[model samples]
Every structure is written in structure tokens, then in C-alpha cells.
Target: MSSYFITGVARGLGFEFVRQLSTNPANTIIGLVRDKTATEKKVSEELSGRKNVHLIQGDMVDYASLKKAVDEIATITGGKLDYVIANAAFLSVWAAFEPFSLLAKEPEKLEKELVDMFTVNVVGNIHLFNLITPLVLKGNGKKIIAISSGLGDQEMAINYELFQNAPYSISKTALDMAVAKFHAEYRKDDVLFMCISPGMVDTGYIDPETALLNDMIGKFMKYAPDFNGPTPIDVAIQRILSVMDKSSVEAGDGGKSLSQFGNKQWL
Candidate 1:
């Protein structure tokens, strides 16, 4: 039997992780969402009678909430946690790259964007890891997976013209290095830390107010040419889980950022 804890389980990739992982009766799934009342009914309705799944309250930017959730999880799991998926992130903000450039007139806005992005994407994940490391160290699996993005890749950003969403892109790059740091510190203790890109799965979060949605689609087409659009949530999660199952420190998978295609072809 294995125990799993996933954040941002109210919707999107986090919800999918809960769905797929809960299917196995041998696994116990604990999901963290920002709003308990908001998600309780929906999760109960969708996952009816799935006793393997449990929901708790958490917010990525709020370390106190996460610590409380982890304390509860520790009691429930008896101090053993097989996996901790740092899947919660703040990606709701999108801005053009040029606007956030060094020469931009509005330095305040750029600073605010960077601060917001890093608070949730980088600092939050780090705090989560620190709180949960003890339980992970006690488990046999000892794996930590942070959901990252292909846009964070410096080379890919240039080649694919990923000039939009500068704050988000930059934050993810910082997150990748943080994961590497965690791996370096914990590898000796048999804990593995890594990041994975979900490969543009569409979750219907498009904003019609700004051209960001359409602009992103157009840029994706230019990058992949043959690519149509984002992958289905279920399909993307399945591939992601496959990669997670295959990862190992002995194979040099730890401390690396990977894609759906695994370590060799990072997104």
C-alpha cells in the first residue's frame, strides 16, 4: 500500500491526479485544496463512495495552512508518506515578455508580478517540502514531484518564441533549480526530487478579456507546427504518472526536470 498527498486538488491537473491515483484500492490519496466548502460537494459528487480519497484545506501561498494540513496528514499516515506532489501553483497571471523587460517604464508592476509568481511557485513549494520531508523519509517510495512547465526551459523559450507569460516562465525556471537543490540535499537519505511538465493540457482556463489565450495558441502552432492544441487532462495525467513510476535516483532521474516523454526529452 502507498500514501499520496497532492495540492491544488480543487481542479485541473490536481483533480486528475486524485481521480487516477484513487482508482487503486491499495493506495490512499489525500488532496489539498484552498477551499474546503467549495470543493467538498464537487469532489464527493464526482468521486462518489471512493473511500480511498480524502480532502484537506491548503493554499500554496499560505505556509500556515500547508503546515496544518501536513500535521493532519502525519497523524493519518502514521508518519509515512510515499509521495508528495507539489502540484499547486499560481499561473493565472499572464503578461507579454517585453512589458516586463529591464527597460520597461513600470518597474513596480514587474516587481509585483515577480513577487506573486515566486511566492506561490517557488517559496510555497519549498515550504511544503520542508514540512513533508520527515514523512517522505519514513516511506519506501520517497519521491517528490513538482509540476513544472516547458516554457521554463531557456533554450526552448528562445527557439519556440515563448515570449509571453514572463513572470510564470521565470518562476518555473527558479522552481526547477529548487527541486535540484532538494534532490542534492536529500538524495543521501533515499528521497528523490524532480520536476515534470504536463505538456500544455487544456483545462478551460482561457481568458477572453485578454488576447493571451489566442496568442498562446498561435505561438504553440508556430512552435510545434503540427500540434493542434492542449492534450486531454486524463491523457496527460496518465503519461505523467507513467514517468513518475519509472523515475529512480540510481538511473540519474533525480534532480532533473522531465517531460511526458521522460528524462531524455524534457518539455
Candidate 2:
């Protein structure tokens, strides 16, 4: 049996990934979520009859909790991790509301916003990967994938005003840089680094039927074309899992950059 790991399983896209992996007959899926009580309740109820799923507790902001989860997963899965996914990220990129309205204004907001953004998006991924790679290395294969956003792209964001959220974009860009760095550092380990944009998915972050719906719809579409095109999270999850199964890596592997729809050019 192949082993795989995913973070941020509380709801939205994360929850969808968990459901697909759990119901599938071929995969061994270990999913991590922030609230053990709530996530566990939901997962327990959902997968009560399933034998392929394992739900673990974790917090993106807490490194120790992440490490503990990593340790347990390594032990439970017998150190055979075929794919490790860094999927947890901030709900949105921008942090501050006033004084620095994605345009310009304050030193304090800039610092605070970017710090939090990077901490969750960049640092969270980094810490989790650092913990998981050893298990993957000890096992049979090595591949790492992270959920990425268009806001992180310099070339894409330059043309789109909707994606120009200061810290959110910066965090994602930083995440891209981290992926590149990990690819290089672990190339000898034969790790294929991958990223997915997930196409403006509407994981129900904001209600669509609420007032100002037209303006909100326009904004979401303008910013995230994927939000309108919105692939159901389960579809994206299956594709990602397929990518994990088909991808190859010899010791010291590289050149494995990709985006949401499996487009090699986006990275």
C-alpha cells in the first residue's frame, strides 16, 4: 500500500480531498486538520466504515504539534511515504484592512501582515515538509507537492489587479521560492517538487447568495478565474493523487514544477 499525507483538512478544499481519499479503495491517506475535536468528529462520522483513512490532529501555526503528527504518521505508515502534500494555507493573502489597502500606507501593517502570511503559507509548509521528508526518504519514493496561488506569480500578477494582494502574493511567491530551493536541496534524494494553483476554487470561503452578490461575483471572477471555473475540490484531489502515483524520481531528482491544472508552464 502507498502512503500519502495532507494538511488543512478542516473544511473547504481540504475536506474534499479527505473525502475522496477516504472513499477510494486504492490509497492509504493520512489527513491532518487543526481542530482535533471538530475535525475528528466530522471525520469519524464520515469514515466510520472506511478502513483506508487515518485522521490526525495538527495546527499549522504550531511546529511542535506538526512534528508530533509527523512522528505518528511515520510510525503508523511504517515510514513508506510515496507523496507528501503541503496543502494548508491562509484563507486569503491580504491581512491588514486599513492604512495599507493593498495600495500603500503603513510600516506596522506591512510587517505584521507579511510576517503572518509567510508564517502560515511559507513557514507552515516548510516546517511540515522538514518533518515529513525523512519518513519519505526512509520509505520507497520521494515527492512533495504544495497548493500554490496565482497571487504568487510575478508574471501573472503583473497583469491582474485582483491578485495584487500585498502579503498574500508575497507569501505565495515565497512558497514558490521555497519549492525551488527544496528541489535543489533534495535533488540528490530524488524528490519531485510539485505545486498546484487549484484554479480559483470556491471552497465556500464567502457566501455567494449574500447581498452585493453581483459585485462580489465580479471581483472573485476577475481575481481568480478558477473561482468561476471552480473545479470541485474532489476532482483536483484525484488528479493530484494520480500525479503522485505516476511521477518518478531517482535519487537526486529535479525539474518537477507544476501548477493547479497540471500545467508545467505555470510554474
Candidate 3:
């Protein structure tokens, strides 16, 4: 049985990742969530009678709280994590709404919004990766995966449909660099890590306008055949499983793989 640790387990992609992995008795999943009050109960309700699922309550901002959760999971499971997914993200829809003239807008609101954007989308994620890397080092498996977007690839930026997600795109691009650093630092350990772009999943976290625009451009981008495509939560979980299966891991190094029409890409 393989064990995995994941953050942002409250809803959307994180919840889906937990759901997909919990179905198998042999797979153990430790999920970290922010909404301590409700998410835990909902997870219990949504996934009842599953002994393999372990829920940890916390957020990416507070290291002490997050570390406690990590320690508990490690102690309980005996530190056998096969994969550590830094999937907890900080994102705000307002980042994409920037106009040609920020000087015309209310400076306070705009400033607050952008600060919130950087705090969550960028800073919080860096904290998450830094907090969990040691656990990944202590774990048994040789895999670490970070959730990223195609827009993060600077070389392919113009070719992507990143919208106006300045903070998100920039943060993810930074995250890719962090993953590369980890890979380089641990080169002799025989471990593999990758930052993956999971496609335009409907996680319901995006702005309605952004979603509509993305969908309109989806045709040009060669969206999945079903058109309806996979929801953010569902596709995220499926991709994790697909990537973990040894048959899918023919190449030992878990380099960057992007998914568009359910097929993996290297970029």
C-alpha cells in the first residue's frame, strides 16, 4: 500500500484527490484542510466507512498548525508517504480583472485585492512547499508532485491562454523553479518530482467571465472530446492516480507533464 500527503482538501481538486485515493484500501491519504469547522464533517459524510482516509485540519498560512497536522499524520502512519502534493493554492478571481488603467480605480480596494492575491496564490504556496519538503524527504516513496498551470511555462507563455492571471501565472512559474531546485538538490536520491498542468478543470473557483472566456477559447486550444470535460475535482484525482500507476510511470523521472485532452505532454 502506498501512502500520500496532500493539502487543500476542503473542496474542488483537493477533495477530489482525497476521494479518488480513498477508494482503494491499500492507498492511505492524509488530507490537510483550512475550514476546520465544516470540511472535516463533510469529508466524513461524503466518505464514510473508509478507514484509509485520515483528515487533518489546518491551512497553509500557519506553519505551526500545519506542522502539527503533519506531525500527527507522520506519527500515526509511521512516515511512509509515497507522494507529497503541494496542492493547496491561494487564488483570487480579482487578479484577472485588472484594467488598462489601475490609476482610475479605488487605490485601496485594488491594493487590498492584489495583496490578497499574492498572499494566497504565491506566498502561501511557497510556505506549503517549504513546510512539506522535509516530510517528503522522510517518506518512503520517490515522488513529489505540485499542481501547476500551463501558463507557468514562461517560454510558452504567449502560446497559452492564461487570461490576465498575473499573480497566478507568475506564482506557478516560481513554483516550477522551486520544484526544479528540489530535483537538483536531491539528484542523488533517486527521487522524481514534477509540476503538472491539469487542464481547464471546472473547479468553480474561477470568475464567471474568466470561465466563459476560457471556454470560448477552449475550442482553439483543442479541448477534450466530451466537451463537458472533467470537473476540477474529478480530473485532479484521476490524474493523480493515473500518474502514480507504475504503468504510467515508464520514465522514472517525473518530469513536467501537461494534460490537455487526457493525454500527457512534456514542456
Candidate 4:
């Protein structure tokens, strides 16, 4: 049975990954969330009675907690993990384009925001790879997928002149580099490391109550007039997983930062 471990499986793309992957009876899926109690309702409603799915409590920002959860999974999965999807990330805190830019001008606040963003988005993901690499090495399908964003593409950012969501974008760029570096070092072992951007996905992480969201959407719409909004999470997840299923070192997917279209377009 293929064994998969994913982080941030409370409500968004992470939850969809667990749900979709567990559909196969031959697959064992382990889901990680910051708080199991907090996610109980969603888990029960969306993933109830799935014998292949297991829930684990952990936060990406806390390496110790993640380590403990990995230990628990090791015991449960017999020390092998086929896929480690680094999907947990922190972004909503300092996401607004203008406000985040203004906030970045402040020395102390900027440091805190940058550190928090990098810690959860970049450092934590790399740390997860460190902890799970051995388990992945033991599995039949050795794939480490980092959930990145098209906003991380520097070329696209320059072309679009997009400067909003700077903190999240910067962190994702670093994450993509880390995934590529990991692939460079581990491809010899037949361990595949890839990063894929899910494009614009509507997971309801954006608060409709926030006045700035409309402005942000307006700004986004300028580039692509056809850009209505994010795609449904399930639709995005299915497309992403299809790409992952077809990826391999032989197909030149290893060490690549791919987009939802399965190309280097970044989106």
C-alpha cells in the first residue's frame, strides 16, 4: 500500500489531498494539523470512517511537535513513508499588498513578520524533509512534494510588476529552491523532489469580510481580465495530483519547479 503524509490537512488543499489519496484502499494516508480537536468536525464530516486515513496533531512551525508526530507515524506505518507533502504554510497574517509593504518599512515589525513567514514556510518545510527523508528512502515511491505558488516565480513577478504579498512570495521562492537543492542531492538515490504551484485556488482562506480583499482581487484582475477568482480546491487538487502521479526523474520532472499546467510557466 502506498503511504502518504501531508501537513495542514484541516480544511483547504491539504484536506483535499488526504481525502483524494485515501480513496484508494491500497493507500494509507496520514494527515497532520495544528490541533486535532479543532479539526474534529471537518475530519468527521469530510473524512469519516476512512480506514486508510489517520489524523496526527502537529504544527509546521514547531519542529519538536512535527518530530513527535513523525515518530508516531513511523510506528504506525512500519517506518516507511512514500510521499511527504509539505503543504502547511503561514500566509494570512501579512498578506495584503500595500499594508504588508508599509509594515515592512518598520524595522522591528518587519523582522518579526519575515521571521515568522520564513520559519513556517521555508525552514519548517526543509526540516520536515530532514526528518522524513529516511522514511521516504525506505518506501517504494520516494517523492517529496513542496506546495509552492506561482507568485514565487521571479520572472513572472517582474513581468507582472507584482509586489504585493511580498512576504509569502519571498518565502515560497526560498522553498522552491530548497526543494530543487534536495532533488540535486537525493536524485541519485531515486528519491524525487519536486515543487508544484496549485495556481489560484479558492480554499476560503481569504476573508470576504476584509475590505482589502476586493482591492487585491481588483489588482489581480488587471493582468488577466478573465481572472474571475480562485478555482475550487478539489478541482485544483485533482489536477495537481495528476501531475504528481506522472512525475519522475526520467521524465525530467525531478528537481523541477512545475506549475499547475505541468510546465515551467509557474501557473
Candidate 5:
């Protein structure tokens, strides 16, 4: 039986991962969220009959909480973990549609946002990985997946001039690097670490009528005109899981930053 640990399962992609993985009664899915009661309610209301799903409270920015979560997960999974999906991150709406030039005008706010983003998106995941790695090492399936973004792709940014969401993009880039570092260290132990972009998933975060969003969409169209828009969360999660299932250290997937399609094609 495969045991999966996913973070930020209160909503969005994290919840979808648990939903899809729990379809198989053999898979033991453990979700980490900041609010255990709320997530447990969600599971009960939506995924009611799935006895394989479990929830634990943890916050990404809290080292002590993450450590406690690791301890709790070890108890639940018998000190072994098959997979880890680092899906929790900080996304700032204030900086979402602004370029660095505009964001630089408010240096104080920019600094705060950057620090918050990096703290959660990069450092927090690093701590979580380090803490849970022992459990992964003891398991049969040693795979760690970091949910990154296409905005992190330097080539895409340079080519399309996608200049919005500066802080978020920067943090995601750093997160991808962090994942690669983990892969470099753990591939020797047959652990597969990968950073995956789920493409543009429609998680109700985008408003089509917003001018800023339209401008971003225009930039995206220049890159891929056929890009209709973000895929559904369920479809995106399914594609990502498929990519994860097919990837392995022996297959040279370790340390790779891949799209849901299992390559660099973000859209």
C-alpha cells in the first residue's frame, strides 16, 4: 500500500490530490493543513466514505508545527512515507498583477511580501522535506513532489515578458532550486524529487473580467495562443499524479522541473 502525505488540503490542488489518491482503497492519504477541524469537516462532507483519508494540523511557516506533523505522520504510517506533495505556498494578491517596477515603489511592502513568500514557499518546504525525509527513506516509494508554477520558468519569463507576480515567481524559482538540491542529495538513496508546474488550474482565483487578469492572459496568449485558460483542478491533479507515477530516479526524472505533461511545456 502506498502512503501519501500532502500539505494544504483545506482546498484547491491539495484537496484534489487527496480526493484522487483516496479513490484507491489501498492508498493511505494523510493531509496536512493548518486547521484540522475545518479540513476534517471538508473531508466528511465531500469525501465522507473514504476511510483511507486522514488529516493533521500543521502550518508551513511554523517549524515546530511541521516537526509535530512529522511525528504524528510517523505514528500514522508506521514510520514510513511513500510520497510527499509540498503544495502549500504563499501567494500575494497585492503583488499578483504588478511588475517589479511598480512593486519597487513601495520598498517596505515589497520587502515584507518577498520575505513572507520566501519564508513559506522556499524555507518552509525545505524544513518539511528535511523533517520528513527519514520516513521517506524507510519507505518503498520515496518520492517528493513540489508544486511549482510556470512563472518560475526563466525562459518563459524572458521570452514572453511575463512580468506580473514578481515575488511569487521569484519564490517559486527558489523552490524549484530547493527541490533540485534535495534531489541531488537523495537520488543516491533512490529518492525521486521533482518540481512540477500544474499549468494554469482554475481554482476560482482568476476573474476573467478583471483588467489585470486580462493583461496577463494577453501575455499568455502571445506564448500559446491556443491556451483557452486554466484547466480544471481535478484534471490538473490527475495529470500531475500521472506524471509523478511515471517519474523515477532511475528514469532520470530526479531534480527535474516538469510540467503536468511531464516536460517544460507549461501551457
Candidate 6:
């Protein structure tokens, strides 16, 4: 039996991860969310009778809440955690569809958005990882996964000239490097730290009728001609778990940023 801790388990891919992982009755699943009562209600409504699942109230941007969460998780899992998935992040709609050139017109708003994204996406995860490393070191699985984005890839951005979502991409790129640095330090202890891209999962965030979204889709098509759209959430989670299961420090997977397909094929 393994113990897994995932953040932002209220909806989207985070919820899907808990849903899939908790299917195994022996697996202890601890989900961190900003609202405990609300997420517990959702879990009860949808994933009924899953006694192994637990929810903790915590916000990624709040260090005190995250610290308390680590203490609570220690009590729940007997001071050991097998897996820690850093999935909580901030995505800015203001910068989603525009390049930095256009976004720079509103300097104040752009600065705020960039700072907010970096705080939650990069700094917050660093705090979470630092707090949870001890528990992970004591556990058997010894794996840490950061959910990153393909848009952070420098080569891909330059090749396709994809300039949208600058703030989010910059934050994720920083997050990847942070994860790599953690891996560099922790690999000696056999803890596998890696970033995995979910590869454009459809979480109902995109409205097909939106002109900007369509324009992004056009850019994607230019990159991958056969790209129909985002993959289903369940399929994406399955592929990610498969990759995670197959990866290990001994196999040289530590410090690497891999896609769900276990390589650089983003979408």
C-alpha cells in the first residue's frame, strides 16, 4: 500500500488524479484543497464510500496553511508519504491569449499577473516540496511529481513562435528548473523528482467559439497537423501515471521534465 498526497483536488486534473488513485482501496490518498468542506462534499457526492480518501484545507499561496497541511499529513500517514504531486497552480486569463508585447500596454496588471503566477506556480511548490521531503524520504515510493506545461519548453516556443500565455509559461519554466535543482540534491537519497506535462487535457476551460482560442488552435495545427485538440482528462491521467510508475532514479529519470508519453511529444 502506498500513500499519495495531491494538491488542488477540487476539480480538473487534480480531482481526476485522486479519483483514479483512490480506486485502489489500499492506497491512502490525501488531497489538499483551499476548501476542505466543499471538496469533501464533492468527493462524497461523486466518489462515494471511498474511506481511504482524505481532504485537507490548504492554499498554495499560503505558507502557514501548507505547513499545517504537512503536519496533518504526517499524522494521517504515520510520518511517511509515498508520493507528492504538486498540482496546484495559478493560471491568468488576462495573459492567456495575448503576447507579452500586447500585455505590456498595461504594465501594472502584467506585473501583478507575473508575480502572482510565479508565487503560486514556482515558490509555492518549492515550499511544499521542502516541507514534504522528509516524509517522502521515509516512505517506500520516494517519488515527487510536478505538473508542468509544454509551453514552458524553450525549443518548442522558438520553433513554433508560440508567444501566448507568457506569464504562465515563464512561471512553469521556472518551476521546471526548480524541480530539476531539487532532483539534483535529492537523487543521492533515491528520491525521484521530475516534472510531467499533462499535454493539453480538456478540462472545459477553453471555449471553442472564442476567436483567440481558435487562433491558438491554428497555431497548434501548424505545429502538429493532425492535432485534433486536447486529450480527455482520464486518458491523460492514465498516461501520466503509467510514465510515473515506469520512472525511477536508477533509470536516470530524476531531474527530467517529461511529457505524458514519457518524452518530448507535447501534444
lDDT of each: 0.86, 0.70, 0.66, 0.84, 0.93, 0.93
Candidate 6 residue pairs that clash: none
Tens digits of lDDT, candidate 3, 1-267: 788888888887888888888888998888887776687688778998888878788767676887788678778678646787777877656555444165236677656755665566556666665666676676777677777776565544455433455556677777777667766766566556667666657788655565545543464244334545434557556765575454223364445544433234421
The alpha-carbon lDDT assigned to residue 224 of candidate 4 equals 61
TM-score on alpha carbons, each prediction: 0.92, 0.82, 0.80, 0.92, 0.98, 0.98
lDDT of 4 by residue, 1-267 (tens): 799999999878998998899889889999899889867777778778788888899888888998998898899899998988889998754554655557757869777777888999999998889998999999988999999988888886776667767878899999999999999999899998999889888787676677766765665677567777888888899988988989998788888888877986543
For candidate 1, lDDT tens digit of each residue in 36-82?
88788887899888988888988888889989999989888887899
Candidate 5 lDDT over 145-204, as tens digits, reads 999999999999999889999899999999999999999999899999999889998887
Runs in model 4 deviating more than 4 A are 99-101, 208-211, 214-226
How many clashing pairs per prediction, in order? 0, 9, 1, 0, 0, 0
Stretches of candidate 1 exceeding 4 Å from the true structure: 96-106, 207-211, 264-267
Pairs that clash in candidate 5: none
Q: After TM-score superposition, what is the CA distance of residue 6 in candidate 6 from its true location, in Å?
A: 0.3
Cα-based lDDT at residue 159, candidate 2: 54
Candidate 2 lDDT, 114-213, residue by residue in tens:
7888899999898888888888887665778887776567766555444335577788888888888887788777778766666556577645564534
Q: Which residue pairs overlap in candidate 4's backbone?
A: none
